[model samples]
Target: MPSPLTHDDPQAFGPYRPVARLGSGGMGTVYLARTAGGRTVALKTMHARIASDTAFRTRFRLETDAARVVGERYGAGVVDADPRAETPWFATEYVLGPPLDDAVELCGPLPEQSVRALGAALCGALGQLHASDVVHRDLKPSNVLLTAYGPKIIDFGIARAAGDDRLTRVGVAVGTPAFMSPEQASGQEHSAAGDVFALAGLLVFAATGRPPFGHGQAADLLYRVQYAEPDLTGVPSSLVPLLAQCLDKNPFRRPATDWLAAELHDGSGEFADHLPDAVLADIGRRAAEVWQIMPQRLLAPADEPDMAETVAPARWSRRRLLLTGGTATLAVAAAGTAGVWAWNERGGSGPDRPPAPGPSNRLLPRKRLDSIWQIQVDEDDLFEEVMQPGQLHVVGDMVVTVAPHLIGVTAKTGQRQWASNLMDSDWQVATDGERVLGLGPSDEGASSGKAGGDPLLVTSIDLLTGELNDPQVSLPEFNGELVGDQLVCTANGIAYVVAGRGKFVHSRFTANQTWYLFAVDLSTGKRLWTTPLPARRSGSVRLYFLSAAVVGRDLVALQEANDGTVHAVVRDTRSGAVRWDRPLAGVKASSVQLPLVTDARHLYLGAGELRALRLRDGRTAWESKSSRPGRTYGPPALKNGTLYAIEKGLGMVALDPGSGRVKWEEQGGQGVEADLKAVPVIGTDHAYSRRASKLWAIDLSSHAPTDSYRTTGNRFIAHEKSRTVISMGGNFLAAFPLR
Candidate 1:
């Protein structure tokens, strides 16, 4: 429903006048507006802060022009726009009917035939968009309007031209959580295929009255979209195969929009038959009402350009706005009452303003910075067995390095304590302080193409002796023929291996795939219990899996179904009995790759914000607000009752774990590219941060940079006990002493 415009809302935007407020989100507010010629439209304006961004404005202008050129047949036509305005505003043809979501809620799920028809129409729309070299990045139920003629896709705010740099800033997920495709969830570049995948998700929701993937926290929903299968329980069986193919995790496997249109286009009556008479009547009534108010023919003013003309050619003078101050002030006013205008106004001095000077490069005269050691480990040979650089773990006076093989080195002397070669190139290593567990595909089975080969093996090594002490466990279920496996270990001597079964046969579903979580004893290398994750009722071709974690004697598993709902279950470590099972509430789990971090007392999760949940009862302890709105937060590093997180826009922040209060923060400068995953490694008295090629050491006492060093690479691991900073540079690992 449209809401009444408040006093702060703009009365007029260029040639359009606001009538009512339509909707709002992180992007900006949308308003129901009308042109002077009596043409009703939806006018969307960027927040003042966004509008003030030169790059953002350039993108908005280019996208709006592309949207206009794409024409109005498949979408809400771009009728008018002013991208160069103080606050960029674009007017699209008013879609009179209720959104598909509202229609579904009001009239229940649509029949199968109607869903097919809806799919055909949306596919046709997508076909047009794709043909025009555009991708409707954000396509969801709310963006689809149930018009009398057909469904019209709306909201092209984030849409981009093909191969264009995505307008989404770093750390921000682009599309809606429930409807985004797997590639989108994984932060991969999106293409026309992404739109087709979203179309399938929308059709499933229309048929089943829920998102294809069950909904929950954004993080969980995103994880499911990226890794798990969709739940199509209530969907029509006849459409299962088509929808399954459409929702394929591999974008290349999904059919093109044109092919989908052909497959779904049975006849016009298919849609009419599935829609309820009441819904049809309501749609008809709304269309008639809209037509009554809409002008029979739109007439452009004498001085104003026609809608077909591009708006890019019309540019206002920047100096003129500065001199008059009217346009600048008006732009801020139109940014709405969200207070974003103040932020934009204060973002920098001006568009051409120079950046602030950086701190001096001189090293601090500290006592501990006397000696350094450089080790040129054979990276080529090591990586021949391990594709990526292995992780570095600090244990007591020894440093444990897992580069396929386990190696122990004395931290103080840089002497090799011991080395064990029991792991393979594909193995993943996890440590329980005293032992390191390696899990991966066995060499023979990995090289074999046969299905019956033994694929997975687990080995354990003692940290102190670096001795391979394992009753090697061979997992036939995760044979090399399957998808893959992941290993996660807790401090409590338990290791959980998530194994995927690829595609399997099921009585009800055709080509089904399942994932199982196996709990293994680090010492004995025996599987204590195996739990098969609950599968979504999607068709045989669908796949599902659970993301499991061990936190404080509790086994926590999070699974998301096709309908976009995430189920988090906490179970007793000993019995595997459910302790508490409920939906995790917070930001969507888009950062599925970031391993969940937990201390003794609470589990810390970071997506758009940082949230802490008590380990004992699974209750939220505290939630820390993001310093910058909509900016994604990196996984948090916790130590001594303090949590350190890196915000994409705000850089590094230190927070009090109990109260979630911000203790200190350091900005990474305006345009510096800091690795989100390279979390600041805290030492006894200093914290090290790596941004690109520079490693900065900040004194913990003053929370300010005390020294900076030029590094060959961006990855840094700190051994606080030895007061040393370890960094990787191609084939070499260098250790620098810190005071």
Candidate 2:
């Protein structure tokens, strides 16, 4: 219940008539009010003293405008605002429920299910704000209202456009210290990552009835936020990893709000179902009382309006208002306020199910490989005993196999000429005919830790002599550095390497790591030049280097940032000067992991679609949409004048390289399954693709099945120039003729 208006409270602010005082805080007092149409709203007026300050007034105006633009979906909908008023005020849809802090105080810690639901709801709200380029500088428990429908994030008084620095001009921190991210405490630029850190703190409180960092003097609290690990002892085991990631001191290491929302709502119980029965009853009672006080004229008609009307209107009708307020209103209206017991009743299709199996077809007859040569590993050798076979690379006449160590074999004679002591685990290898480059932990570093210790060591080996080159490079270690492995490619006797380095251990709003593209002379092992790529805002998930290649004497690499932005960068291999950097159209960086492929004039890449970029300036040459859109997986291979790739729902698609026109497409018969492991390799008249234990041959002209070859292993590497393919199974390595 709201308190009676005091003598100092004004009777009206603009068109709103004050009915009662809702609450008061440092910034202003909120009053329950009614519009001319008799719809209830929460009116907030700045404190007289603060309103008098010029800076405060400017900030208030920015906040009001930002809140309006942010709209109502994720927060309280802004109905009106008069920032220029002597006592500036704004009204939002009145939320009828207790603050999350108060509810927790009254009802104790929320159950794990409820916490998950709460996380999903808040994640959605925060994601909306972030998507609009707004950052809620203040996201404490008091700012969240646990209404019957769900949680409503209110009070955008301190929120600002992301990267805005007006409030940080004097090195003064703006948010409440207890919930402030490390960047906020340190008076740094705020970004969406800061909001993520604060949301994690809110989750910690919701799950354990206590803030992760606890409470202390402002300075002390700030110190802890910057340097201390959060107290996550009571967090559920399944949720611990995610929560821990969110609370990570490095903002870049935190997951984005959108990703979090997906992880949370992924078929779990409805958020309202997690509330305690007593809490639900109390919230329902409050909503019912508020509904009765609201004017009946403002109530929506018995028949609900179309979704379009409900979505477009700024002022929600009574029915829409009730649904938007919180979960408690939903419970009361549905008469299903069974609380925790109603968990099972909230129906949701569980996590997405895979496509149903189609009709079966007869299996194709197996064909045998015409082996040119074979090398069998000795059972007593360390390569066969301890090392897992890595990638196979063929450069010129040398066939290089990576494992516990590097081995160089003569492609013609299958002779093991020489071996190096360098470790290949967790490493990426690339070759350019003359030399082979390896990017991974060194043998010295791998023995010290399971994942390996940094310096992320870079080594060069002569493909012919298997000699370790001089001036090997090393990079500084940081959390999740060298994610998945750095991408290395070579061209014109220069090796191009893309790697991530730097520590994210202390900051919580800005990226603490840096990504670099290095160019080195393969023969001398001398660094030619190094260029740092542009940094992005920090996020919970670490960025990974997806793929890199040398195109027409330039280096092209694709990387996914922590915030899910995928970048395709092209640089001159000689000078290391950036030529062009642009995001792959309509693709999230996390969705594509295949290395980019390049012809003399164009670079080819596949995410959900097949895209080709001109090698000169990284301009889109052409883009061919897959028949199944997002179902397209793996990289695209260029053979002759056609581009070939396996479509997710469709089998194979061949496209004209210049125009992106579909040349031919083939789908697996109802009962037949096309095995897709390695990318398609073009032979003279057919395209060769592999499944786990079989190789598929598709005719180029007719797009019909040619033959199926059975291989003993699932892993294979193709050498187009040599017209040979090698398959590795156990200790055996077999080379087959493509012809």
Candidate 3:
């Protein structure tokens, strides 16, 4: 129902006049508005404070594009839009239909015929978006509208290009919890196939009056989406198998939109004929009611205190229900949920916002055969760009996580060996395969936000206990409090670091900062080399190096510059000299914050294409021709002597490192849609990767996933001796069987 316009609500915005408020969120507002000709529209506008942000504006523009991409046949038509306006907004035809959730609440679950017709129309709508290389990441009952023509998908706040994650942060999961696809719930990539999975959830709801995954807190819903099976008890038997296939965890197994459309309906009867009579009557009533709505604006609080106090106690007069009588029952034709949207906005980062702290959602430790073990870890708090996602390190029998602190867990049993708060920032911690290193003066003020000029001392951490081995080395020239400083990578006997010289700072990155990348020999406690790094702009959130790792004698790193561009650079580990540098085009630094894929001979990458560069001189090597033409490849993972990658339609394929030749391709699995962003875990007898909410262990002997385990882990690594995979994500640490 339409709510009275607030005193602060704009009377006229752009070319349309706001009739009443439809909904509001942290960042913006959606209103029922009309043009000069009295044509109703759902006008969306950002708050003045949020509109000033450039990133939010870009997202709003993309949202407008996504709305247009859906077109008029399957969605509310875009009547007018001006995202560049002072408030930034777009107007779409006010859809005169109850949201699917509301419709279900009123008339109960629809019959099989009604479901088939609605499913077909939605398939066509999703098919259009897929054709445009877009995916409606958020598809739920509340975002769907039931009308005489068809079911229209609304709320494109989280939709985006299929694989373009340049604007997205690393580990933030978006979309409604109950209806999100498995991969999306795990903070991985969600493509066209992900949409199919969510659409099936909607169909299940329409047929059974409840979501396939059921409802719960966000954490439980996320875990269930990735690990549990959908409940199909009340669904029609005829549509059960079809919906089951669409709900398959592996996206590749799900039918294409066109195929699903064909199977769901024959295009024989009109959509309205299939809908329940009660629904059709409700739609008709809504259409007629839209014309009865009239403008009503509430007055602001009276300036005189006595006047305000005297008027506060009036009954219906207090709320000022201006449109009383039968006209008051006319609901606002909201384009999205009856004025409710789950944008998950975090100030400047729209749907890409980082997860806020929720103690209730924390995953507790578990002891089960299905999982080797599970233990809790601290949430992202080091810094937005540096250690927010919490980097995972598996060395020897230990798994280390550095997120404003240091945590050591036994790889085999998920045992907590040591935990320390001395290493308060990510830059203060570093570890080699066998030993751990930290830069500090173990004190409360050491890692405080300010960049203080404290004596920098290099120390080693005891593996048995979380004690710092003091007097190892000292850098009299540098400070320990540089927020931009980082312990880049540690390998062999060398400790690589990027440090800055600056005074106390109120900001993470101070304006008067001077930075450098240096190296020191851990055994001798002697500084090896120091080279100057580029200066950063004021208030820049990104650090100099997004991620770095040593590849034998080469130091391979992804560095983010002041212009927001990232570069793939190789520096000599012995001299700290840049051997070669190239712009990492079509790659987002934040998305690839993992250890760079490199070996003794080549540096492999999956940006645009699956290819490699010779580490010696940075020359382009042969590209992989192991899959069909036009088939894109996921981020490549190298193990043993072969390269493993997800080929768009071919699934997991092994390629020869030297020639990029097809050594072998996966034969069977749930679907061809493997995670395109996360690197697969390579084990001795099995190759493990995530699909939906489960991790599939592909047997090397048969080239198919023989066993699977439920998991919400965002990053996975193999622990060889323990014969287990250490997975970290969903604010939890877990271990699963390797073979």
Candidate 4:
């Protein structure tokens, strides 16, 4: 397939031919070519300048030989090559299809099955490469080609043979630092396990659509890959164990390639089945090791603070979750060996609607909340929602979310109400008991059709009809609160508003130049005085604005100063003057959110720790300190006077809010990090907890056996008046009636 180089120059040399362009990289270009005899081959040529150097040619020869020596497995096959050719060329089988990055971008991450297949193929390729004493210096998404046949590892230009002197030639580091194993990045020679580490990196890219180290320059990337653990939080639960093994920093700990291949091949049909036999063997082996080592190392030292103080102790609680308990259940035959099971019970609150007229106690693992069916509404390839404060706001039965666009979904069904197309608006929706208020597109130099100097556009729609009750209203300073019909807000440091409208709007801009909070007048475009508050440092000390809320007649604007104090200023809604300014001591806050709990006496806020504070005075009524061992990231849910807190790996903790007394706790599975996305939901007679990917319900006010609701996928807690619903994983939200 190659065309002869007929230029005939002495430097160029003979009838060298050009073949199909294979791929380009930082070092050189590769092509699929052939000799005059029609034997197919791959040819890689160095860029002109690098090709001219004798030292470069020698290194190229070593890389070519390493490629050929690594031979065929599931990857592209390296054939004969002329590393000594004038331009220094090597040949490999031409592979079809786009790079893995392109493939995922075009078609999304391969499903669990394909992901397992891809992993198996790459593991096989690496097994062969490692066996031949070669280290693929670069193993990134861009270098791995996803052919129709399977994934084929390619672009081994910088590959190095074990103990090859060519690897240290001149200044060539010989690997993409981001994908390089930590040991290799520390100036050590690549190990077989390092290739396993690189394969882990590729798997992470396949799962999250971004490298674990994120985008950065070579040095920063290498620094991160060396010291930081890849954020595998979003990875599918089934693949976590395999990836964790592959990413083991110590070479001895990494699973062998044979094991990896078997894991992939066996698990290719269903993610649940993909456990490499080696991984299972390793888990058992490690468990024994952990048991032996942990006893000597003091896993639970005698004098450690009592974890029981954080939550309840034993009745299905999170307090004891820190214990590295290894209990397993074998009830469901289909659940296989690994994976968590839903700890459920029966006989709780009746169904919210007509209690499903079915036989009771049927052992349906997936339970439908009375009148409520779960629906996993999230689309594939979607990024985690990252809206602050009001990201997840509920207005009647309609919940509006603004991660950038104004999206509305039915609170009961998870069905999309509507997704707006207006760009740069960044809409935020709030409600005034009757109508929905949208505040956005009214910032200075407004690009959207909302406004320019008075960038705040206020529209009020009936909460039930989703129809505009009041036409567009223009208000100046575009920030504030709604006390009944008064639209109070502030902009440019002065609080003002268009009064007696349908709703009040407020706009608060953060230091990052994005509006954190914006409220609009639901009735008339009247000029409202806007007050600007000092900005605060976020959790990472990033510049951001303090948030505000309208409680009764008080407009409380809370900010965390440069010093770690939560400054709360209560402004009068009628007048712009501050009623009281007090800093809550001992509360280190990045951002504080007060969930709209139905009681004015109880204030629910989230920061580094989830705390229940009294509204009358800045007094911590109760706090869930997740800083303890085993307690990861999760917020506590407060209902009535009881609080439900969860710890990673442990289960749920029920506490008495007023006394900070542990009432009950449950032993779930895994840690809080696994189920942080969902909060516990409580109804009149029952409580529901989401663990890992399952939902379970516990009955209260009963001395007999508890009622349990079971569900699949992820579960989220949604509250409505007297009814509570569980957003069961896989698009099912079930509502239970409180009776």
Residue 738 lDDT, candidate 3, scale 0-100 = 83
Could you give the C-alpha RMSD of every candidate to the true structure, in order shown?
A: 27.2, 22.0, 17.5, 24.7
Tens digits of lDDT, candidate 1, 445-540: 333423333466777766666655667766666653332356755557677776655532212122355667678776676778887766545441
Error of 4 at 64 (Å): 45
Write down the RMSD of candidate 1 (Cα, Å).
27.2
Model 2's number of clashes is: 17
Give the winner by TM-score: 3
Model 4: residue 333 alpha-carbon error in angstroms: 44
User: In lDDT terms, which candidate is top?
Assistant: 3
Which pairs clash in model 3?
Answer: 226-693, 252-672
Measured with C-alpha atoms, the lDDT of residue 434 in candidate 3 is 84
> In model 3, how many backbone clashes occur?
2
Distance from true location, Cα of 123 in model 2, Å: 59
Residue-level lDDT tens digits of model 4 in 564-664: 56676556665555666677654444334333332455555543355665656546676656324324435567777887766555656666766556687
Stretches > 4 Å off in candidate 4: 1-386, 411-417, 422-425, 442-454, 462-469, 476-521, 527-529, 535-549, 563-565, 580-598, 605-612, 619-634, 647-678, 702-715, 721-739
Question: Where is model 3 more than 4 Å wrong at Cα?
Answer: 1-369, 381-388, 425-428, 440-452, 504-506, 624-629
Q: TM-score each candidate.
A: 0.42, 0.42, 0.50, 0.40
